[model samples]
Structure formats: structure tokens, C-alpha cells
Target chain A: MAKNKTFEEKMKELEEKVTLLESGEVGLEESIGIITRAAAIIKELEKELDDTEGKLKLLDLKTDEITPLSEDEA
Target chain B: METYSVSQITKKISCLISADTTLSGVAIEGEVSNCTLHSSGHLYFSLKDEKAKINCIMFSRDVRNIDFLPEAGMHIIAYGRVMLYEKTSTCQLQATVLISSGMGILHEKYNRLLKQLEAQGYFDKEVKKPLPTYIKKVAVITSPTGAVIHDIINTIRRRNPTVQIILCPAAVQGSAASGELAERIARINRHNLADVIILARGGGSLEELWPFNEKELADAVYASTLPVISAVGHETDFTISDFVADVRAATPTAAAELVSFPLEHYLAHLSAQRLRIAQATTLRIEAYRQRLKVLKRPAALTQMLAKNITGHRSNLTTLRKQLAKTAETMLIMHRMQLANLQIRLEANDVSSTLAKGYALVKIKDKLLQNKEQAALHEPIDVIFDTFRLKAEIVEIKGETYGEKQNI
Candidate 1:
């Protein structure tokens, strides 16, 4: 009900919507409606994924240096 | 003493022991020895501590409940009845329950501490903080140089390369371990840096793992604002830290997994979801198109009116495209819907998340998300986050689910 859904919650909601549409029980307009809502969820999920991927900064065990390690180095 | 038959004496002793409630349902704690599991599934063992020993018999019915065979040199608490066997005329315990406490005194201490903390509401679900929806940064508290840290890092890296870990090196054993662990946990909370905290160490014996059982670490865990995942020892060893932390992972690697979201797997899942939605829409459209095709097709109808509409057009074949378009226009749902699908079926290039998570309203190309705006079934360009879309206003309803999903 809330827009502040966690990544897990958003993914779960998307799965449920897809399942409902795939069941072939819902009407054409309803399927359209479901897909429209799913698009919004996908946008948020994709954005989150991008944000998560970019957060590659880490703290070393011996040093206090806050180094932004590249993908390979991290 | 009165002279009596052996059977009579044995029966009398049995009756005496049965009548005594304490002997009937007593729990005796000691080292187990001479253990034998009979072919019939019955367990025979002797419980001994220094000076004395007691013969114990756990029947097959009761032995069914036990998971492990009663091996010699295992310390356990046996619960059942103390009685005399009539045939042998020997006093022995008939045990129904056996709880393994391998390390004797240390095990007792662990149990005692566990109960005390549990009673104090240390392990209450209400007190436990929920792990973040997706953890971005995690603080790991473990030995700086060891397999524990490397194992955790590798597990996390393999699952999600993007997850960043802040190493809070602490002694995982000996007297200094508890203080160092407590200090590190406190420090992580103080900085408010990470989404979660992982308290971890490699597996060791009870004594070697004693630091995790100390009250000092528990005090910090209870006070920590950040969610704590305790992975102090192997799956078999559960310390006081495990009980106190928000979650108790079986191992350090498991703890890493709890914090790291599997990035590639979920991205693939999202892609699959998008494809499924598209497929469902395409299937529906195909079905409608099939139904339209089966209908007498506007060709015959248009041929009759072709002379009236296009006076010069002698060729109805060339004008069939216009006729079909006219028929599709009659079904307004098919027209705008096809256009809508065209927009959705395009490349999914989302550049940014909306300033507001999801807008309740949109006008022209810009989103007009506001508390004041009515939640109507109006289509908005929700794909390609920053990109604009063309949408038609439709009848709105309260959120049953989503109103303008597919369309």
C-alpha cells in the first residue's frame, strides 16, 4: 500500500502482478492496468539496482582509509 | 530383616520408587559411559560422576525421540524413572529424555547464561531490529587476519560485488576479545555508517569461543541501533551473542549472505518480469487481433461504401488498410492500447528514480505528484524515469491494486 516499499517488497509485488496477468483470468483493461503499475515498480527497482552497484567504497582492515575501490579491486 | 523371595522384593522396590514422584520423573546430570544401543532400538547406558554410577535404560519407544546414539564419555542430563528390574532384581533408571551437554561445566554455564538473558528479554523479537530492505554498506567485526574475514569477504563478493564492507577488526578469542568486540559494535553504531553489522569468528571449542558468551558483548548488541547478525562459531555452537543479536547466522559466510543482496540474480529476475508483462500484453493483443480477423472483416462493409466515400477509388484492395484502421478506431481500447504498448515495448532505459517514489498525478510530460492530487486511473510515462510520455485520462478509483498498469 505504501510507496516506500523495500527492494524485496517491490520485487514481490512485481512477481504477484506478473503472475496475475499470466493466469489469463484478468480482462484486457485490467491486464493493462497491472502492467502500468508494474512499470513504476520496475523503474524504482532498476534505479535501486544502479545505486547499489555504484556503492563500491570500502574500509580496509589495517588502514582507516575510506577508499573507493574499483569493481576488481574491491 | 524379614526373609522374602527375590521377585517379591524387586516388585516391592519398584512400587516404592514409582510411588516416589521425585524418583519417577527425576533428571540426573552426569557423564555417560558403557552406552549400548540394542538392535531393538532400546538404549542402555550408565551415568557416572567421580565416586558413583547409575545404570540407565531408555526404552525403544522413548529412544525414538533421541537423535544421537548415547556414546561413551558424553555428558548428558537423563530424565525418566528410577526403578528395579524384576527379572535381574537390579536397581536402574528408565530414562525417557537425554540432552547432550558435551562440555559439562562450560555447557552448564552456557545454559544458565542463556536462560538468564532470555528471561531478561534479550532474545525478544520485538527488540530485534529489522534488516534493511537492501543493504548497501555493512560493518564486519572479526579477526583482521584469518579465514573468517576472508571467507565472509569472498562469500559477499561472489554474491554481490557492489556491497561495501567496513572491517572492524577485533580479537575473536581470549580475554581481550569481548571488550574489543563490544567496542567495535559500539563504534559502528556511533558513526551511523552501515546499513547492518556482522559480528563473526571462525569455529573453535567451547572455551576458545567463550568471549562471545560474555555479558559485555551482549550489552553492546542490545544497545546497538544497527541490526546485528551474530556468526560467532560453527552451526553446532550457539553462544549468548547468537541469542542477543538480531539474527544468528550458522557461519560467517552465511552472515555475509544475509547482508549482501544477490545483485545479478535479482536484476535477471526484474528483466524476466518485464518480459513476462510484455508477453502477457502481446498475448491479449494477439487474441483480440485474431477475433477481429475472424469477423466478416470491414472489407465487405467498406466495399459497399467505397463508392460513396472514395468515389475515385475503383481498387478496394488498396483502400483495405484505411478500412481496417476505421474498424480498429471503433474499438477505442485497441487504438490507444496499441500506442501504449509501443511506448512500453521500447528500450527500458531508466536514468533516475522519481523525486517522489511514485507520483499520484501527471500533466503533459512532467509528473504532478501531490497529496492533494486525486488517485485516478490516468496513464503516465512511468518507464525511463526522466523521460516523458503521452497518456489519456481515464476513470479513477481507490487503490484496489493498480489502476493504469498495462494501459
Candidate 2:
């Protein structure tokens, strides 16, 4: 089986890349490239968040049927 | 003889016995009585018949193959020479073969010993201590000039070079060896130098390794605070010490290997620990970084605020414009509707009909439209748009001229 990279490792690497890009010390040629890579990582992180949100929504949907009656009806 | 010294007399007696009787091996059968196994690995006992009894002695080397314990009251068949002890001036049997009466006696003795130890809780699993994975220091009790020490040292050095070895030289065989071994073990315990102790020796015949089977040595091993590893004889060789020690290894080399950890295994363990720590730290940093990133995004905040303001202003402006347009359209429509209604009202006006040239004669407020209904000389009102005349119907004129009239 292939080894899996943990969430922390991936996040740390992306954060480091972002820091290097934002430092403004790198040459312009490399800066753009690093920014592009950082943007991709950010997209991946966003997708992960979206997937988690979707799962939570599914859980909510599963339990959405049991609504309470209004005061007037009761 | 009367003039001879004591030494001369003893020497003369010894010579006479040696010359008179020949030393020969013999087999005798009797019940063992007053049996004693000395510390020197020698057997001292008495063989008794119905009417008589004889003393017997078996040296350590001769009794090497006796499988069962030789005890008093057990019937045994013995083979050895009849020798005379000059000091005691008694003849006795020097036994070689001391077989028990039957298997029943040996089995009973084994069960009795096992039961006694079990009752004392010696075989309880809870009393067993776990062996250390890496022994920092190991004390070995064995003969100084034996292959056991050399083998243990070689195996330990090859496997783990850092472990310290302490040699406790003691006799490993013979009768006195058991007491010596127990004493040395106690001494080691008092010093408290080593983390573990290995009672090791090379393979030997059963009788040669009988010292390790002594109950005193077993008790000493059991009572020692330090963990003991017993490696006596070969793989199939088991003794009382083996049962009492914390761990039992088949050979000296195996005992050394069991106590020490290889350097490679340690390095691997350290590496795995480092990886876990590194991964956990990285994850923690990333989690904080992500939170910071969310906080640092000013664009999202500004965009959200601008969107809210724009939406609110647009909604207010749209509401206002719709309200004004609705009011204006309603006013224009209402005005047009009012004008149309006025036109309809004028079309249905009675005054307009009157202005269209219709006239009538009335009696006060009642109009008379039929002239026949008017009586002659009757006073009536003439109604017109401009004039109202009071007149009397003077004549009844019928069929006058071309039109019929009643006036």
C-alpha cells in the first residue's frame, strides 16, 4: 500500500511555501511561480473544507425531518 | 605387634586387607535407608534387608545416570564393589547402579515435590518478572575457565557492545558447588552492581550438572532482587534453578542475546519516535497557520462590507423609485377614469334631454303628456326650457286641419 501524507505535513509545506512567496525577498521570476503554487495549495485546502462541509450537510439532512409544531397550532 | 606404633599397625592392616580380598563390582538389591547426597555430588546411604543392613557410597562420576531421586525407604538395586573403610572398620557397598523399586516411588516423589512448591506459590504467573529488553549490566555465575563465559561474552559483544559484563567465578559442579553458587549469588545481590544475573554453564551429564538442581540454589535465585536468567546444560536440560529464575535460556549465547538489544533495533525505534513527533509538530503549526490565514484575508472582509452597503442602498433606492412611480401612475389613471365617468354622467343628464327640445304641460309638479287627458277650461302649466305658462284648455278641437289635436 502507498503511504499517506498526513494533513499536518501537507499544510505545513503549503504554509512554508506561502511564507517564502510573501517574504518579498525572492527574485521576481521565482516569486510568481511560488505564488502560483501557493494558490493551488490554497485551492486544495478549500476543497477539503468544502468536502467536510458537504459531509456535515449530509448529516443535517439525515436528521431534518423532525420539526416542532408552531405555538398557534399547538 | 605389642611393640609396633599406631601408624605401623594401621599400615600393616591396610596391606593385609588389600592382599586378602579383591575389589570386584557387585549388584545388590535392598530397600534404601539413611540416604544422604553430600554437597560433593557423592551418595552416602544404607541398604537394608529383613535382618541386616549395609552402608553404601556412590561417587559423583558413578551415579551420573540415575534418573530418579534416591531416597530412604525406597527399594533399589545397586551395583558396585564391596570396600572396607579402615577408619570405621566397617565393610560397605560402593554402589554404581541405584535403580528404584518401580516407577511408582519416583512418580510419587515427583508429585509430592511439585505439590509442595505449588502450595508455596512458586509457579504463580504473577510472581514472574518481565525481563529487561536491554540489560545495561549482566552478572554471570560460572566457572572462570570454561567455554560458557567465552560464548556469552562473544554473543553479547557481537549483538550489543555497550552492555557491561561482570564475571562471578564459582564452582559449577560437584557437591560443594551448590552452596558456593548460592553464596556467590547472595554476594552479587548485596553489591547490587548488575541489572540482571545469568547462571550459565556448558552442557554436561545429569550428575555433573546436579549442583544446579539443588533446592538451596533455587531458593537463592528466587529470592534475589535482580532478575536471573538460567542457562544450564543443553536445550533439554531443566533443573530447579530453571524453574525459579525469571527467564530460562537454552544456552549461554542465547541467554546473552535475550538480555541485550541490538543497536539497529534501538536506532529504528528512535527514528520512528522522531517521525511521530515531527509529524505532530508540523500538523500543529499548520493548524495555527490556517487560522491566521483566515484572519489575514482583508479582501474578504472588505468585499463583504461593500456588498452589504451596495445591496442596502440599491434596495432603498429601488423602493423609493417604485413607490413614486406607483403613486404617479395611480394618480394619472384615476384622473382619466374620473374624466370618463363625467362624460357618461353628462350623456345621461335630464337637463340635456330638455335642452334637446322636448316640452310638457303639467298640473303643478305633474306633467301631462297626453292632451286627451286635459279637460276644456281646465287650468294647466305649460313647461318649456325658457318658459312656464299657466293656461286653460278653452276648446276641444278634433281633427283640425291635417293633424289631430286635443287642446
Candidate 3:
């Protein structure tokens, strides 16, 4: 659940949970919990996808500093 | 210094030229002129710039390594040692390696570095990190204002807009481009900015793409903590960075695809998982419902009871028939007893006797059989089968043959 984790990490987590649920060994309460977690992860993934903003930031070659390029510049 | 003969002087000059470290193994880049291939498998030529020319020779062994046969006006870079030709008493270079200039020079340099790096295990498959399945952030190192960056940005945006693109601008061509690209890669690594990095450029002449072939850039790609996708030129062109990188894409747009997953793919996968889960849960609940139906118990018991009731109803019908038969038999037995008693009564023939012997008399509710026993007068009753008469004994009779007493 760490914000620093990449989208791939979250996808892996969701996939593992789904696999566990499908194994049929989980109790009813545990399966419900897995479904809840899976739904949450899916919501997060969807939010991330919908929130995509193509923001370009420029890096100063000499100083290694970054400057966000404004939309008007394009 | 001692006075010497001409051969000694020439030999000493050769020694002096060879002894100088800078001249001993020097490299000169220029165009070749008066190129000659001798019968002894030796190549003789003049390496010249506009300002000066130096006589150069390559023996058969080194000549075998040169890809192209040298002709007049072929530019080349020759690496060899300066020595004196004793017969000519002149300084010349003995080239150990000869490479043609321009595209040939770039190709030669690129190949030599590639081989060197390959031998060093820089491009080992074991060292390559797999690209992430879902890249959330990408750091792009390329010239900022070019079709290369534009293609990359547009491709990723069109496919998967969620990926964060951090453009680390650098020179894509010229002498400083390689170092600048390497530096930008290092900077991105230091910041831990992106999940993957893309080193990209548009197609160009080999000279324009030379920077991508630099060892420094290749090493930078190799040293990156994040996985890298190299897209330096058209599909036909391959750079050292392409070989060193974790993944190679034919063009800048392809690199973008390598880093990001298409949104449609993720959506479809998610939908499939959702459907599978729904089906699984439905199946589980239905199975449970079936199990519950079996465990309910009374349903089976009621079926058993209904079966037994059918059996008991037939048993009761048989018992009723047997009871009726026994009752009929008892009635017949009672009737037969009554009939036998009536025959005895008939055999006694009380009515016949009464008819033959006239009347039978009773005095004081008793029948008198002897008149001698009678006292005075008494009322008597006589009965037959059809009628009865009441009477009184009024006379006494002495019974014996002729004795009779009256009172």
C-alpha cells in the first residue's frame, strides 16, 4: 500500500490476492476480506489511470535542477 | 654523443623515435593517399591532413583485420609506432590497426567498443533487469527538442496516459552528447525518479548516432539501477546502448510502449478477474445451498413416514376382515347350539304327550302325578305346547286298586 510502490507492484498484489481467493481454501470471512482488498486496489488503479497528466518538467543540464514546463510554453 | 656512421645515426634515430612514449604508440587520423598493396602482403600508404602527411605501413597480419581495402583518398585512423626506415633514412609509422574514417570509422569504433564491452560482460543477459509490467513513471534522456522526444511522449500518452514522464534533456549528438546522456542517467538514478529509463533518438547517419555507441553511455546504461529501454535509431540501426540496455526498441515510440502497459489491456484483465470471481462466488453459494438442503433431516423423515402409512393401511384392512370372519363364526356356533337344544325339546315331545294323554294337571303351582298324595281340594293348572289352564285340586283319592277316600 505504500505510495512509493510502482503500478506493477500494486498489480502483482491484486493478482496474488485473486489467486488466493480462487484457491477455494479460504474461509468465507477471509474470502470477503480478500474481495474487499481487491476492490480497493482496483479502485486505486483506476484512479491512477484516470488521473494521468502529461506534465513535462525540464532538467538543467549543468545544475541538475528541474523546472516544470508550463502548458503555455508548448 | 659520439660520432657514428650513417647506419648507426639512422638506427639511433629509430631508437629515439621508438623510445618516445607519445610517438611509440600514437594514433593519427587522416585521409590515405598513394595506397599500395605489395606482393609480400604489406600495405604502404601516406596518412595526410591538409597540413601534413606521414608515411604509414601495415603488415599482412594487421592488414587482414581491416574490413576495407585501402585506396587513394580513403580517410582513416592509423594506430602504430613511429620508427625510422633505415634504407630511406626517414621516419615512418608502422600501423598495427588501420580503420577508415567517417562511417567506416564510426562503425569500426562502435564494433571495437562493443566487442570490448561484451568481453567485459557488460551485456550479459544475467545483468539485465526485466521491465516492469506496469510502469507508473518514466525518465527519458534525450534531446529535448526533437521528433524523438515528441514521438515518445505522444506514444505513451496515446497508449497509457498514466505513466509520469520526466524528461531529462541532453545532447543527442556531437562530442559532449554521450557524457551528458550518461550524466542525466546518473542523476535520475540518484533521485530515484522513475521506474524505468528510456535513452532515445531519431534515426540519423552513423556519425550523428555515434554518441550512442560511446562506451561511457553504454556503461551508464549498464550501471542504471532502473531498467532501461534503448531506442536510438531506426529498426535497422543498433547501437551499443541498445545491446547494453535491459530492452531494445526499434524506435522512440516503441520504447514508450515497452515501458507502459496499455490502458485497455489493464481494463480487460481487471474485468476478466471480476467476472471469474463473480462466477466462483456464485458457484460456492449454490453448492452451500445444496448442502443445506440435504442437511435439513425432516424432509427425509417425512418421506419415510409416508411410505410406512401406505404399508399400515393395508395391514389394517386385513385385520378388519379377520375380525369380521370370527364374529360370523361365533354367531353360527351360537345358532347351532340353540337348534340342538330345540331338537331335544322336540324329541321330548311334550306337546305330543300332552295330545295323547289328554291333560296334565298341577296343584299349588305343582303338577300332581298321584291322587293319593293330594289333600282335600286344591286348584291346579295344566299347560300344553299351545295353551295353559289354571285349576284347583278339590278331591283326594286313595290310590290302590279300589281304595278311594273322600273328605
Best by TM-score: 3
| DockQ score of the complex predicted as candidate 3 | 0.40
What TM-score, over all chains together, does every model reach?
0.45, 0.46, 0.58
Compared with the true structure, all predictions reach lDDT values of 0.80, 0.70, 0.83
Q: TM-score for candidate 1, please give it.
A: 0.45
lDDT of 1 by residue, B337-361 (tens): 8788876765222122343353323
Between prediction 1 and prediction 3, the one with superior TM-score is 3
- TM-score between model 3 and native: 0.58
Write out the backbone clash pairs for model 2.
B39-B175, B39-B176, B40-B175, B41-B175
**What is each candidate's fraction of native interface contacts (fnat)?**
0.53, 0.00, 0.55
The residue pairs found clashing in candidate 3 are B377-B393, B377-B394, B378-B392, B378-B393, B378-B394, B379-B391, B379-B392, B379-B393, B380-B391, B380-B392
lDDT (C-alpha) at residue A26 in model 1: 95
- Candidate 3 residue runs with Cα over 4 Å from true position: A1-5, A60-67, A71-74, B1-100, B301-407
Q: Which predicted model would earn the best DockQ?
A: 3
